[model samples]
Target: MTTIQPTHRRGATRLTDAGRDIATMLWRDTIRTARQPEMLVFAVVMGVFFLVLFNYVFGGAIGAGAEVDYLQFLVPGVFVITALQGAQQSSMGLATDLAEGVTDRFRSLPMSQVAVIAGRTLADAFRNLVGLALVALLALVMGYRFDSATGAVAAILLATAVGFGFSWLGAAIAAKVRQPDMVGMLSMFWLFPLMLASTAFAPADSMPGWLQPFATYQPISVASDAVRGLCDGALDTGDLVLAVGWTVGLLAVFAPLSIRIYTETD
Candidate 1:
C-alpha cells in the first residue's frame, strides 16, 4: 500500500510538471509576439486590406442578384480565410525558432518536448483570436451585420479552431525543414487552393459543376459555410457538426506528425 501510494504520487507529480512546462512554453511564445508588435500590425494590415479589396473590388458584381448584403456574407467568409492565413504565420514562426537554435535549448531541458509544438500552436491560436477580432471590427465598420448571436459566437469559435488545426501543418513543416522561408512557400501551396476553391470569396453553386463538389466538401469551405449560415441567422447543424469534425480531424492527424518530426530533428 505504501509503495503504491508513492508510485501514484510520482505519476501525479509528473503530470503536474508536464502541465507547468507546457504553460511556460506557451508564455514564452506569447511574449515573443508581444515583443514583436509588427506581427500584429501585419496581421491587421493584411486583414483590413482583404476586407477592403473584396468589399469594394468584387462585392458589387457578386452581390448583384442577391437580396442580402454582400459585405455581411463576405465578412464571415473573409474572417475564416484570414484565420487560415494566420495559421501560416504560425508555421513560419515555428520554423524560425528551429533554425535559430531555440528548439535545442528547449530540448536540453527536462521537459516534454511536445510542449514546444503545443505551446506554439496555443500561442498562435491566441494571437489569431486577436486578429479575428480586429477583422470582425473592420467588417462591422464596413457595415457587415450578424443576425444570430449564437451563430456569431459559433463562427468565431470554429474559425479559431480551424486556425489551430491548420497551424499544426505549419508546425510539421517547420519541424521537418527548419526553414522559415521554406515553410511560407510550402504552406502557400496548400493554403492557396484550399482557400480560393472554397465558397469564401464566391458562392459554390456559381462555380464550375465539376469543381463545385470538391470545393464544397473541403474543410475550409465546410467551415466557411458554417460561418456564413451563422452570420445570416440560418442555423445549419450539419455544417457546424462537419466543421467540428474537420477541426478535430486535422488536429488528430497532424499533431503526431509534428511532434514526431520535432522529436527526430536535430
Candidate 2:
C-alpha cells in the first residue's frame, strides 16, 4: 500500500510553497517594473501635478478660507491620492496582462495561482512607496514639513497600506472584466467619486451640509485626516481607527473575491 502524507503536513507544505511562489512572482513583477520606467514616471508625474496645481491654483483661496497652511494640508491628501493612483495602475496592469494572455502562461505553471495577483499588488505597493517618497521630497522643496521623521514614515506606510487594500479591489475588477479599457473605466468610476467628494482636496466643512456626512466619513477623508494628523503632530485616534478599519474591510472583502474570480475566469 502506498503511504499518504498527513493532512496537517500537506497543509503546511502548501502554505510554504505558496509563500515561495509569491516571492518569486514579486521578483518577476519588480523586474518588469524596472524594465518599464515609464510606469514609474507616470505615477510620479501625477503626484507632482496635483501638488503643483493645488498649491498654486486653488491653494490661495482654500488656504485663506480654511485658515490653515494649504501646502501642509494638501501634501498628506496628495499622498493618499497618489497611493490610490497606484491601486488604479494595479487594476490596469493586471487587466492588460489578462487581455494579452500572460495569465494563461502563469496558469500552466505548477505554483500557487493566487500568487499572480498577490505579487502584482505587492509590486505595485513598492512602486507606490517610491512614488510617495518622490512626492514627499517635492513637498519638502515646496516648504511642507512633517512633524517628525517617524511621523512621516508612519504616514507613508499608512497610505501604502490603504493603497494595497484598494489594489485587491482593483484586481477583483480586472479578474472579472478581463478587459483593460473596461477596467480603467471601472476604476475611475469608484476612484473619482471618493476622491472628489472626500476631504482630500478641501475640508469637509467647506462642503454643503447634506454632503458633509459622506465627505467626512468616507475612506479617503479618514485617510487624509489620519495622515494629516501624523504630518501635523496632532494624531486623532478616531481618524486612525477609521482609516485602518477601511483598509482591513477592503482586504477582507476583495482579496478572496479577486482570487476566486481569477480562478473561475475562462
Candidate 3:
C-alpha cells in the first residue's frame, strides 16, 4: 500500500536539510573570504578614512555648534556607515558570482537555493563585525570612550543587525541585476543619498528645514541615533524601536524577494 509520510516529519526533515545546506554554504564563503583578504581590508580602510576625515577636518565646527563632543557623535555613526559598506560588498560579491556562473553551479546542486544568498549575507555579517571592531579600537585610540562595555557591545550588535538587513536588500539587487558593475552603480544610488543626507556626520537640526524631517527619521538617522544612545549610556526607546523596525522591515521585504528573484533568474 502506498502511504504518505507524516507532514510534520517531512517539514522537520526539510528544515534540517536547509540548515545543513546553509552551514555548508557559509563555510564555503568563509574560506573564499579568507583567500581574498583584500575584501576585509577595503571595508576597514573606508571606515578609517571616514573616521579620520570627519574627526579632523570638520570635527571642531560641528562639535562646537552642536555643543557635543564630535568624536562621540561621529563614532557611532561611522559604525553604522561601516556596516552599510559591508552590505555593498555583499551586493558586489554576489553579483560577481552570478556573472561568473558560480550560481549556475549552485543551482545544479541538491540544496536549498536560498542558502546561497543566506550564507553570503552571514559571512558578510561576520566581516562587518571585524571591521566594526577595528574601527572602534581606532576610535578608542583617538580619544572616543564608550559609556560602558555593555553599551559598546550592544551598539556594535545593533549596527551589525542593521547591516544584515541591508545585506538582504543588496542581495535582492544582485539577484535581479546579475552584473557587478551595474550593482555597484545601483548601490551608490541608494547608499550615498541615505548616508550623506542622514544625521551620521552632523545633527539633523543643522540641516535646512526642508531636510530635517527626513534626516531625522530615515533608517540611517534612526540607526545612528540608536547606536549613539547605546554608546552614551542614554539609550532612547524611541530611536531603538525605530531602528529595529527599519531593520525588520528591510528583512521582511528583501529576504523572500531576493530568494524569489534568484530562483527565477536564468
Candidate 4:
C-alpha cells in the first residue's frame, strides 16, 4: 500500500494562512449574524440604553470638577462594558454550536483547527464594530462627539481586539464546561463584578476609601482611561502598552488554551 502523504499548504506563509482562515470564518459568522440579527440589535440597544441612563443618573453627582459632560466619561466606560458583553456573545455562540452538534461537524472537516477559534473571534470583532458604531451614532444624536476620528478609530480597534481576546477566553471556557447556561451565567457573573468593582462609573478617588486602591489599578479602569486618552488625543506610550498588554496578553494565554481544549475534547 502506498504511504499516505500529510497535507501540506505549499508556500502558504503563516500570515497568508491566518488571513485565509480568518476571512473564511468571518464570512461564516457574518452570514450567521445576518440570519440572526436579533443578537446584534440587542447589543446595540443595550449599549445605547446604558449610555443614556448613566449619563443622566450620575452625571451631576460626579460633578464637572470630576468630569465635564459626564457623557464623555460614560462613553469610555460604556465602550469597555460593551466589549465585555460582546465576549459573552462569543461564548454563547460556541456553546450553542457545541450543544447543537455543529462543532463536531467542523472537527470532521479538513479545515485548520486554529481556524475555528480565529474565525469565531474575527467574527466577534465585526460584531463589536457594529455595536460600537450604533452606540457612537446614538451618542452623536444625543450630542456626543469625538475630537479626532483617527484617535477614535484607534481606540475602537483596540476595543475590538480586547473583545476578540475575551471572546477566545470565553470560547475556551465554553468548550471545557460544555454547558451553555452555565457558560452564560458564569461569564456574566464575573463580568458584572469586574465592571462594577472598577472605575467605570466614577473615578477611583470618588470611590469609598476601602475600594479606591483596587479600583484605581483594575485592568478595566486602565483600559477605559486609555480609551479616553485616545479619544481626547492624549495618547501616551504607557496607555498603549497597557492596552496592548491586556489584549495580547489575554489572547496569548487563552487562544492556545482554547485550541488545546478543543483538540482534546470529545
Candidate 5:
C-alpha cells in the first residue's frame, strides 16, 4: 500500500495541499446534498411554514407599531430561528458519518484532521445561505421589506456566520457522542426553548412577568434585536455590539470545545 504523505519544503509545512484537500471535502459534501436534496427541501419548507404562520398569527396581537411592517419585524425573527433550526443538518450529517466510519477513513488519509469538521461546517454555511435567501424571497412575496440595503446585507452575513459557528458546535457534539438521535434531540433542546423563551416570537416586554430578563439577554434575542434594528432603518450601536458579543462568545467557547472533542474522540 502506498502511503499518502504531507509534503514539506524548506522546513515550512506545505499548507496549499491541505487547503485543497479541505476544499475538496467541502465540495464533496455539498455535492452529496445536492444529489439527495430532501434535507435541504425540508429545511426550506419548515422556514416557509413558520414565516406564513407567525407573520399572520401573532402579528395582530403583538402590535409593536407599524414603523416597520409586522412581516418585516417577523422576518428577522424567522431568519434567526431558521438559522438555528438549520444547524440540525450539521449534527445529523456528522452523526451519520461517524456511525458509518467515514470519519475514520478521513483520519487515515494524509490530510489535516481539522478539515473534517471545518469543511462540513463550511458546506453547511453555504446550505444555510441558500435557506436564508429562499426565506427572504418568500417573505418579500408576503409583503416584507427592509429599509437599508447595507444593514440587510450585514444582518444576513452575520446570521450566516452565526449559522457557521453553530454548525461547528453541532458537528463537535455529534463527533463526540457518535449518535444521530441524541445529537438531534440535544440540538433541538437548545434551539426550541431559546426561540420560545426568548424575544424571538415577541417583544422583550411581552415576555412573561418573571422571564423578561432572561429572554432579553439570550443570544438569540440579541441577534434578533440587532437584525430588527437593521430592518427598521435604525442601526443602534448597542444592538450591533450585543450581536457581535454573542457570536464571538459562542464561537470562542464552542469552537475550541469541538476541536478538543474531535481530537480526543475515538
Candidate 6:
C-alpha cells in the first residue's frame, strides 16, 4: 500500500520549483561526466580527427573544382556533426540509466519527470559547447576564418539547435528501447544516411541526380548550408528559414512524445 502511493503520484507530478528540479538533474549529469572525463577526451579527439581528415585529405582535390574555400565550408558542417555527436551521447547515457534502474529510482521521487528529459538534453548541449569550442579553436589554427563574428555566433547557435532537435530524437529512442547499445546501433542507421547523404561532406551536385533531391532538402543539408553561409558570408535566407523550421518542428513533435515515453517506461 505504501509503495502504491508514489506510483500513483506519477500521473500528477509537475515541477513545484521548475528551476530547482531541472537544475538538480542537470547538475547530476554534469557531475557524472566530470567523474568520467575520458568520454570528453574521446569526443575532442574524434572532432579533431574529422577536421584534420577532411580539410587536409580532401581540401586540395575538392577545392580545385569548386569556387568556395574548402576549409571554410567544412568547419560549420563539422560543428553540426560535433553537436549531434553530443546528442548521441545523451541517448546512450539515458539508455544506460534506464538499463541500470536509475530512471525507476527517479520515477519514485516527487520531481517533475519532464525535468529529466529537459535536463538531460540541456546538459548534452552544454557538453557539445565544449566540443564546439575545441573544434573552432582548432579550425582557427588550421586557417579556417569566419566572415563576421556575429555570423559565426549565429551559425554556432544554429548548429547547437540542430543538435538539440536530434537530442530529443535520441531521448525518444532511449525511452523506447531502454538499452544503451541498441540505441547506438539503431541511431547509426539514420544518422549515417542523413549526415553523409547531405551537404556535410560534399556538395549536393556531386551526388547522383536521383539522390540529390533528398540530400539537398533534408534537415542536415539545410542546416549545413545555412551554417556554411553564415560563416562564409553567403547567407541564404531560404535555407536558414528551412533549418529553423526543421529544428522547431522536431522539438515540437518529439519533446512531448519523449516525455510521455519516458514517464511510461519501466
Clashing pairs in 4: none
Model 5, residue pairs in steric clash? none
Runs in model 2 lying further than 4 Å from the true structure: 1-9
User: Model 3 reaches what TM-score against the true structure?
Assistant: 0.95
Q: What digit string (tens of lDDT, one per residue) describes model 3 on residues 63-179?
A: 874667889989999999999999999999999877776778989987899899999999999999999999999999999999999999999999999999999999999999989
lDDT of 5 by residue, 66-102 (tens): 4645676688888887887777777788788778867
TM-scores of the candidates are 0.93, 0.95, 0.95, 0.90, 0.89, 0.90
Tens digits of lDDT, candidate 2, 1-266: 88875646577788999999999999999998999889989999999999999999999988885558999889999999999999999899988877776788988887899899999999999999999999999999999999999999999999999999899999999999988899988898999988889888999998999999999999999999999998889999999999999999999999999999998844
Off by over 4 Å in 1: 1-11
- Index of the highest-lDDT prediction: 3
| lDDT tens readout by residue for model 4, 89-164 | 8898887776766778888876677887777777777988889878878877888778799988887777677778
Error of 4 at 194 (Å): 1.8
lDDT of each: 0.85, 0.93, 0.94, 0.79, 0.78, 0.85
Which of 1 and 2 is ahead in TM-score? 2
Tens-digit lDDT track of model 6 for 55-167 = 88988888886788888778988987887777788888888877776777889996778888888888878777777878889999999999999988888888988989999
Quote model 6's TM-score.
0.90
Which is superior by TM-score, 1 or 3? 3
Clashing pairs in 1: none
RMSD of each: 3.4, 2.4, 2.8, 2.6, 2.7, 3.5
Please write out the lDDT profile of model 1 over residues 1-266, one tens digit for every residue.
Answer: 34434434477788888799889999998999889888877877877887899889988998897896778777878878888988999899888888887667887887888888889889989888898888888787877778866767777777899889999988888889888888888988989999899988888998999999988889898899988887788868898888889989888989999999888843
Residue 185 of model 2: what lDDT?
88
lDDT, candidate 6, residue 50?
A: 76
